[model samples]
Target: MRDEWNAPWGSIPELVRWAAVRYADTEAVVDCGGRVRVTYAGLGARVERAAAACLAQGVRPGDRVGIWAPNSLDWITAALGAVSAGAVLVPLNTRFKGAEAADVLRRSGARLLFVTGTFLGTSYVASLRRAAGEGDAAGPLPGLPALRAAVVLSEDAPRSFLTWKDFLASGEGVAAEVVRSVRVPGTAASDIVFTSGTTGRPKGALITHAQSLRAYDTWAELAGLRRGDRYLIVNPFFHTFGYKAGVLACLTRGATMIPQPVFGAETALANVAAERVTVLPGPPTLFESLLDHPARRDHDLSSLRLVVTGAAVVPLSLVERLRADLGVETVLTAYGLSEASGFVTMCRRGDPPEVVAATSGRAIPGVEVRVVSPDGTGLPPGSPGEVLVRGFNVMRGYYEDPAATAEVLAPDGWLRTGDVGVLDAAGNLRITDRLKDMYIVGGFNAYPAEIERLLAAHPDVAEVAVVGVPDPRLGETGKAYVVRRPGSSLTADDLIAWSRREMANFKVPRWVEFVPDLPRNATGKVVKGDLREASGP
Candidate 1:
């Protein structure tokens, strides 16, 4: 284990101190909804207060605190607060139903939960209560023995749940100072980030703080993130891409962050113009939506100095359109996963247009990437193989899953990325496909196996297989082929509706086909490659 003094700013609180010293009065975070602005100093104080509150609740070092909220000021505050309190922050997807959300909360062993009362039209508190096995009329979560308390983010405080204002108010005066001094030894960059797996289970990738900060610093240095530069964050905070690239990077570099709760292309464009955002990074879908918007012509995006797209394979045409129509000088492509603390490979700022469009760029500083065959042998350039990365940015291992960790992280510390890619002579990475049946829908990982498992649970379904099909808008959408049981008459609409109820909205299959039997290979494996190809464009 690395010494705390030698560690690269071991906690988010440390990073906050750095930013506060440099840009104390600058607007650190801006929410356009209520036009709420939090200056660096003010943000630091709130973080300290929240941290104190966590400590008051007996949250010690390495304790898991679940953050089940949407993209908001409170979400960021709670995340930083947990880190400051020396607790491992576990961010839950807001789209999850009660059962799904509870599973993550229970599995993570979260002692406290911070959730919004409501987001958009969804009631998060209601969902969480139901998931906790406390039905609508029930008081507190029934089975969450580990959960000490629930803090609701609302103007009006609930009877059973503690309100955000009251929670923050609990950490006043000298208590905040004591919380600030409480430091843990092992709170390095290598912590766990629970990402959804193809098998419907969430795997906690152990990414170190060093790896995360390296990604932030590398991108900041390469992208020229100067002080006073504003960034527009529309990407959800749960994903590593958004957390590391969007939030941490900005916080580390003294850049202002303008967060949008939900993504609306027109609203994003307006915010960009309003905030004079200099650096913007999101999935290609966001940019595509912006380009397709009729109002884009009227919006002024000239302030954007750098535009980055990653998480999914970016279309070359989209790259061309941004440069041609939007006048974006620096268009970059990045490639990484939850295990690598966001991005390990990214195109440099001044690279030639073709190179930027074709590759995931060179490995960032201190990171080593190699393309290797299935037998663990190194492959020559241009030969596609599993991309293995070993670096400061590589995760320590999966949390508490030694067998799963050993399978991916070799004896030599190389982390098998499970992504099929080829390294060019210049070491640029071009991804082919994922080794696991994982597909990206609008930059979010949608595991076909997970969706298939959910679809099979439907009463009318006998068996089902889900595969990714080409989608112009989302990049890829799930298409399921089902074999109904004897005497069962289930239509595609029925399966779709069932999926919408059983799983998150994004995991629902866009198209469903009834087939007598699924094509299988000689080895008795369902041939998804054939299904995807046969589905057609």
Candidate 2:
């Protein structure tokens, strides 16, 4: 018999429209700052206005619009606005530097950018200016020649860029009321999420609206989301877990979202009780911190009915503590990547505590997962191999990078997740390690190649290699082994300081070791595995 839950949903916009009608008077989005709340009607109105503003800025169908901002009501508004304007939304990590941000903007050919003035202690306007300056110098940003304007989310805009209010004013009042004349459906490349590649560069994984919607639809079912349920969103909106699982799921299910710009353990716990948040999903680190917070016992988190965690390997002890202390009955463990548009495997709400705590759970209905050996042969149960995924939720491909796309997407449409895992006889997936030289620190994927590339760019560094070292707080932190140029005396502190200025905080190597030469194999390739072992516990 066919599963009733596996039925296909047509499009994403349908869900948006559904929420507009069903929860018109319900509080849809609540910004913690000043307790700003937007009803479904207000959200729909703002999305249309933002869409019209984007169109006024010359964004046409299929044009990419980059959103480099943190978690906020406006960030979600701009995303829906871009979609309504028939533009593909490109969400850039707010932690990215000007150069890294420029690479994605240039590659996506984003004509317009929507960014916040200040987010998580960084000035986006300043970063945009830095990126724009690179464009003036005929750099990578020049590839996005269509990029002429930036819309900043602030009352007082930057010197040259347009303010969010002013941009909305430019659109005709009725323009926001306009609805799509065409019925779009199922995997039409709605957004592009950039994931760090093993080759040091980033890959823009093109996810259609349908794929994202499918993720939310399936996840909502798994999590038991429903109308009036409130969700505390601490995950960054730029990540798929936040956008698809947290925001979109809430929107589609007529649930309310309590938006938190930054993740602080105390703030999250307080918000959960204050907002009556029923659903909470974040990285394991987030939950651990909240559980370990000195003031956790003082807060009333009893309202939390469900908590989902992913993006890193969660220790079983942490899972047990969540259930014992936090009273979270439906604790789920899920696994997915940007390429899968969020979740391919997940533990259902009613799953046994041990199943939820110890395993990544079964594949979501409609998603097929396989464990394959190096020779492309399928591995049996309990055999570890590179995890391959095929599903409706799989990304279309890397935007404008066919060669790179081909390397990951097999002709049969399976996406090589580069994650090493084994499937038990019960079909639960257990991730062992990454096949690619990438490490997860606090849920952020950091590629050794990327850090090594940045380190090699330093004038004092002749050769460099990076490996992950175990860390109690971050799970895994980068440890760099560098060979300085002859007569160049750079201390470990110097390298750490330099990295802080050059890369994102999470990507920076926590410890730097100076060495004459890196361990190499017979073929002269740096043995990163050996380095990891040498830097062991």
Candidate 3:
């Protein structure tokens, strides 16, 4: 996986080892939720132990390893360990159901899985076991034929699954020098971030070590992240922004991480005041909630120095409020997607409030962004068209889906971002519409096709279509138009309840309308434009 462009300290293990020496005494990670703190030296030691555990469990280079957990010290150690063992990291959505998690694990042929015991009241282990317990695979989860082992990240585990303690203890026998000399994931696919495409199938975007490091190094630089800055990471670790911009960026700049598994304005304020958090980056809703929170004035939010927000259109008033109301030093907005290695454009620090609020700033270094017509011709500035990108930051391709890969990525190194945006005369990019009908719910990309696919499985749903509708809190949420089967009396409440149990929370449609039939165009395609109009502004 090594490449000429791969940095010596690019990979997780390499970064851990290097940071351990450079910032040994500096606070690295403080899990306020768990009441745990780990310095760089401690992170390095723990990661090394986890990597040894990975080897002891028979993980090999190029093997698919999955982590299904929330933001925590255990999640970081487990994911870094898998990569340190030369395994491709596959982070599962914490909001995912057992079925969805198993679907990815099975498709990726994950050899090992690290799962949390329980989170937000549901037992993740119980959910996964029930979902994957009936298959012919002789492993811990019988349904997953390729999964050889499951490590529970808690004190207790089923007899079949290995506890986190036992898993690490097995690696104690492995020589330290051997672990040090072990393979470092370089230019190879360090991770396969799974994203649902317009076709309703999950596609894994392959990003290499060099690409991630180079891009985020450029990101941390552009974002003006500095050493000793305490960052409160509210973004889920599964997304590229969280893993790369949140974790990787901190490592690059020696910033301390304060991971929050679930977001609550009250909790966030407490952390900012107590931990002296100086850096905060998240979706616009994060800032909005914090500003509107009843107890906001109770906490000493004066320590907040920076905020980077995007994934939805940022309001000019919101930007003004963050600066004026909160007295924040700097605020910026940016845009990205999974196919583009989770980054493409960002606002510069000194940009005016109008530019920062109006558009996702110019492309990061080494990347070319274009507004093109349907015929593939470039458009003039201010003319909206499909957004296209090309650069070292682009992903290798969608893992094992060359056809889908070919659909977006051209042979000459261009990636069709499937987003409609306008380029300002100054080269700033402002995204307008999602060409694939995808929407953002609290910074998570939700494809309508994916949600429709999930809904279509219901026995009562004879036909279904989903569209993004504006929401005050979450930015945007799904609204489903469904047709019931003959004589079926499935109510919206019933379907919504079923969806909560079946799909991730973000994908569950917040609004459901029982329609006679979906409006179709001349080509028999559901005209989403009419649906959005009917949904109202």
Candidate 4:
């Protein structure tokens, strides 16, 4: 495995091609809903065909291709193909609304977009078109000046869009030589992942292919992901957890990628038992749901060997329960962000439940992690301060936004994670608090700045401040303290309903409190500490 890791591979396509030859007959992907299975050899061919299709569409090297869809065979194929065609892949969060997706599409200047017509009872194409408007009357979708085409992954494509089948069929005209010629370098940008920014907008994080492959290679090794292992990926494909750790990791390890689009406990249990899945990685809530479900024992989960979970705090009892109740041998905890290719500190096997529960584990090989004071000096072990990371895993920069990139990323390569943590003598890191106000809801990052910006647009809202309060189910949910406009009769429920229409569900404040005015510091900044205290424990 070490020798294989040292081999020279330049890009995603090269990795796929090598995997095809090395693990030709090995199962690569299994679409649970479509009941489709593809081998390594077949998956490689599909990626190449998708690349040819992209070339036929006149997509040039370095072009941005946006994929706005949920996890599926088509999603993976489209993403891999675009990257193979030397185009930078831009993945849109499935949780995003039409306006949100359109904003990213416009900012990225994506020439082509692949969208799911419908998923989980919502029509994405229809919603985006509605947001973008119809025909010449709309005047080029407001901000999306470069968006020329969209391919809908459905039976019928929307107006001015191509169907999935037709999009692939367009490749028939492009010669294989054209696809082969568009070779992207390993150090070049592979994917531009947009994460919620502190400035109320999403910033694109440019990650290279070599960094991605290297980061996940160490990750797979630490997680005990082995050849022939059936990996049930419940994590969203948009995030690095699913795309890099789930899809790319499978290609490197010859594991079977069984993508579970939406996570439901009953469905997950049945799939684990039926498919004889050996590995399952998701947030702690997933395992909690599985354990709390009544029919958990009904499924034969004896094949389950590895479980990797992080993001939210993993209760000590949950870690113990996962082993005692389910017989999962190698349950590990990890920590990372989208900027780091989702590779950072990870707990090793055989660690005690207390250590696993309290700390995020030690840093992965080649990554440097430090707890630093406000002065940028490294703090002593056990002293809580900001967590700073510098390594091969850190992204090149936020795409096309050098000013915003300069704020968080240092010239010395240290990335200010905005997370506060303490390192033990053993080098295990225990996250104490966050320097930033960002919070996680069901493993998804919900930035207060982004949510507050949306809420501030409300006609009834005069002033607003958002904070993260503890929640048993989702780990943490947003609580908004709002000062309403004069004589406005807006109820908490009313504001919630209005927010639902304006923003993504995760970003919506679950709780609303009407206040005369927010408690402010001398600098005229809202004191979130006071609001958090007022909201109560």
Q: Which candidate tops lDDT?
A: 3
C-alpha RMSD values across all candidates: 2.8, 2.4, 2.2, 1.9
Writing each residue's lDDT as its tens digit, candidate 2 over 159-245 gives 657788898887665443454553455556788898778888888888887778767778888888899899888888888888888
- Per-candidate TM-score against the hidden true structure: 0.95, 0.95, 0.97, 0.97
> What is the per-residue lDDT of model 1 for residues 309-405, given as tens digits with 9 covering 90 to 100?
8777777888888888888778998888888787788888788877877888988877899999989899999999999998777777777788888
Off by over 4 Å in 1: 1-8, 135-139, 157-159, 185-191
Overall local distance difference test of candidate 1 = 0.80
Candidate 3 ranges with C-alpha deviation above 4 Å: 1-8, 134-137
For all candidates in order, the CA lDDT equals 0.80, 0.82, 0.90, 0.87
Model 2 off-target regions past 4 Å? 1-9, 134-144, 173-179
Candidate 4 per-residue lDDT, tens place, 223-245, comes to: 88999999998898899999999
Clashes of 1: 7
Reference-based lDDT, residue 129, model 2: 66
- Candidate 2: minimum summed lDDT over ten consecutive residues — where? 1-10
